[model samples]
Target: MEFFEKLKALSYRARLTIVLHTVFTLAETIGGVFFNLYLWRLTSSLALIAQYQFFFWLAMMLGFILIGYAFKNKGMSQLFRIGFWLNFIFFCLIVWLGERSINWTVYLGLLSGLAAGFYWSAHEVMVLSGTSDKTREMFYGVLMSGESVARIAGPALSAGLIWLGAKWRGEALFGYYLLFAFVALLFLVTELAINRVKDVSFERFSLRGVFGLYQRKAWRWNLWRSFVDGLMISRWFVWGVLSYLILTSEVWLGTMMSLVGVLAIISNILIGQWFKPNLRARLNSWGAALLVIAGIAYPLLLNPLGLVFDQILGEIIGIPLFTFAWLAWFYLAVETDYDGKKRQFEYYAGHEIWQGIGRILSIGLFWLLASNLEQVNLARWWFGGLSLLFIVQWWLLKKVRTALVKAGYKEE
Candidate 1:
């Protein structure tokens, strides 16, 4: 009853944004579930997968940099619309190219990445603007729940549709192209919904001012943390790929993803309700440590089922606990720099540069290692190595937290 009351109190802008997010997110998930699989079917090259992903993050980082300048004159709504249309165009190209898309992986990846980078960057700002402190919690809760449900439902339905369609249409590629068209066409709904949102103005900071944000000590430290965060959240490191390879079945892949999605939803619910400031250090530490454990343990199994177990620990337990706790730390540490207002968007832009670099490096490193190392050892070495950075982040948080407290900063 209380949650419903809060939900009812949301502004129209918030409502429309929620609708846009739900539809866009659903289409993205449906299209994404099989996109790589389609590529894999065409070429079966991990190196190509890594190359496609490398360019995606490369363009995404560039998109962030360019959008920062664009925001000087353009509204977030306009940028979002551009991203929305670019994504629509991306899917349209995939449908049109069909088998030929395999040759254009790098270009397609760049287009999609730019679309994602701009859309997410602008959309996040819109979310912050659309709701006040009183209603923000409920707004995010509803948005997250919708996203979670889409993750659960989209792949399940798409997998079934493709399997059935293979028999009816007599070609697997036809099912994929059909799904791409559906996703591309679905954007019309989001386009209408987002246009309904009135543009709200934020204080514009000069590009010089935005770039100068890096001079501050607190934010400088946060960039390092966010870089590791990006490495952890790499551009093309979807776990289901390994699962699909091992299981050799789309249905199995969807089932594993849905089960993991259910567990993630449950974990997020529990974490959101139970998280506390005093417990931040402990939870984040546990989460980081668990990720390392999962990474190291996963490759040992060498079975398709290992993917499910790895996701259970990594996504459900490790990711949520660490992510929530680290986010709490960011609010306390990073967002508190020098009045923290008049430059919120600038802070976001500066952070994106390093984070995007980190993502690009992640795939770049994988490609290099794939050249020399055993493919089987990739997860162990990659996850183990990256998890070390989490520990570094954990220490940085402690140092920054104490220093901020001494400097008279407090979590809002």
Candidate 2:
């Protein structure tokens, strides 16, 4: 009850931003997870999926590079609209392609990447502008809670729809079409709603200027954090979990994801109330340690029982800690310099580029490794490597905290 009141007390722009984000999150949750499943069904080749993801990240990097130019010339609102429309077009392509989606997976990946790059870059800036450091943590908590609810509903709804379609017409693809169409409609609504939100002024930005950050010792930790974050996103969540799902049932996948979503909701609430800014550094360290442990436990994917335990452990223990801590750290890093307001878009674009490089390396390695190894050995080695990467992420997180402290940024 108190939480609801506090959420309602947010400024109009903040509330609008949260609402818009929730809608977008719901639409994404509906179809985003299944898109990979759709591809795997079309072509049961891990290498092909890796290729698609590689191209996706590559294109995303390119999109980030162009984001600065877009922001300077067009403004954040236009970039947001372009992203929304591109995503709609991508889903439409998925429907049109149908089972033949395998034929154009690479191209689809590129399209998806471009859409994500533009949408996320603009979205990050909006979040920064809409909330202050005082309200940032609470706002993110509400946002994440909303997203978790959407995630819970989205997967179940998608799975039920797919099941019904398969039962009625003897083809689950029909359900996918329905899901994509629904999401496309949501995108249209989002496009219209975006107009109601205020826009940020155009600021001078350059891709070349991003190079200057590399020269600053104070900003070096952010670069490392970006790369590590990218690695985790690709190796653990994208390829690692997807690989497990490929071996399991869709019903099980949907159920497990919903369970995780429920746990996320609880974590969001707790973090919102208890996570203090002063405790950020210590908490983040603990969170990164849990992630490393989760990565080490990835070998449990060998058997069904072990797989279930592994998922439960990750969702219940590892994800909530790491997710909240990382987000808090990110907010700190972005807002610490205060100059982020005028150059926020450029900073985000640069962050995306670094993250993209990390993902490219990860998926590229996955493609190469999977090509050479058998299924059993591949899972072991792939997840084992991912565990090592998590350690690197932890190290980077610590360094980031140290760097921020040295730069005279207040812990609270």
Candidate 3:
């Protein structure tokens, strides 16, 4: 009750952004869980999924660079709407592709990545402009909570729809098509809503200048943090593990994902209300440590029981803590002065590039390793590797706190 009231006290722009993100999250969750399943059903190759994601990250990196330039020259809303429409097209293309050929999955990944880069870049800018430093954490918490709620509903609904389609048309693909269509409609609505937001413009920045920020100690750490963050959150780790579980057991995909969502919702509420600014470092450290533990435990529990235990721990503890830390640090990075509004795009662009590089490395590595190993051995080795990677983030969080302190911020 108190938390909702606090969220309500935020500025109108912040509230609007929350609403927009909630819609976007709902649309994403509906088809996102099933996308890999669709590909897996069509082609039972992990390599194919890896290649698809590889290209997706590659395209996203390029899109971030290009779209950042566009945001500087044009208005933010234009790029955002373009992203929305592109995503709608991406889904439409998938519907058209429909098991006819698995080869097109690569192209779809590229298209989805491009759409993501534009949409997320614009969305972050909106979040930056909409909330002040005082209200940023509150806004982020509310946005996350809203996303958790959407996630809970979306996966469960998607599962039911898939079941219905299987019963009615005798093909689960039909349900995927329906879900994709709904996602398209949601994007259209989102596009229309963007028109209501105030328009803001920025002066153009040189690509050279943006890339050159890596020389500074703070910027370098920020970039590295983006990479580490990217590695932690990549699909290869989260979805890859989950997909393996579905393949091995009779676990209901929608129900399991929805259960995770339910836990995530509870964590979001606790974090939003109690995770104060001063406690950022402490909470982040704890989160990082827990993630490391989960990583270690996952490979040890390579069987069904281990997988279930890892999944439960990750949802209830690992995700919320790490997410809170990352969001807090990111908000600080964006809010830190880099000259003026003119250069904000460059900062974000640089951040995206670093993040993309990290994702590419993580996914590309997985593709390489998994390609060589027997499918039976892939999950175990992958989980081990992923657990070790969490240590990098733990180290990076400390560096971020140090950097923030040096920048005259009170506390991380």
lDDT of 1 by residue, 1-412 (tens): 6556666788877787777677777777776658877876787655667777888878887787677666754577777688888989999999999899989989999999899887777765666567653344355556655666777877776677677668788977777777778778777556655663477544654568666866766666777777866786532354545666677887777776777767666666556455555666688789888877776566666476566667888777887767665555454443455555446667676677778777777888787877676654674456556656767777766665665667676444
Global local distance difference test of model 1: 0.69
The true-structure Cα RMSD of candidate 1 reads 3.0
Candidates, ranked, lDDT: 3, 2, 1
lDDT of 2 by residue, 1-412 (tens): 8777767767776776677677777777765667776666667667777787888889888997777775574557787788889988988888888888888978998998898888787778777777876676778788887888887887777778777778888987787788787788778778876873467654657877787767545457778878876775545434334544545656667766677788888887777656677876666667667666665666644556545555555655556555665566666676776676676666777788898888898888878877887644575666656766656766777777677777676766
Better of 1 and 3 by TM-score: 3
Which segments of candidate 2 are over 4 A away from where they belong? 236-247, 304-308
User: How do the residues 127-233 of candidate 3 rate in per-residue lDDT, one tens digit apiece?
Assistant: 77777656666676778878888877787878787777777899887887777877888888788778645676556566797887676555677788788767754
TM-score of model 3 vs. true structure = 0.92
RMSD of each: 3.0, 2.4, 2.4
How many clashes would you count in candidate 1? 0
> Which pairs of residues have clashing backbones in candidate 3?
none
TM values, all candidates: 0.88, 0.91, 0.92
- Candidate 2 backbone collisions, by pair: none
TM-score of 2: 0.91
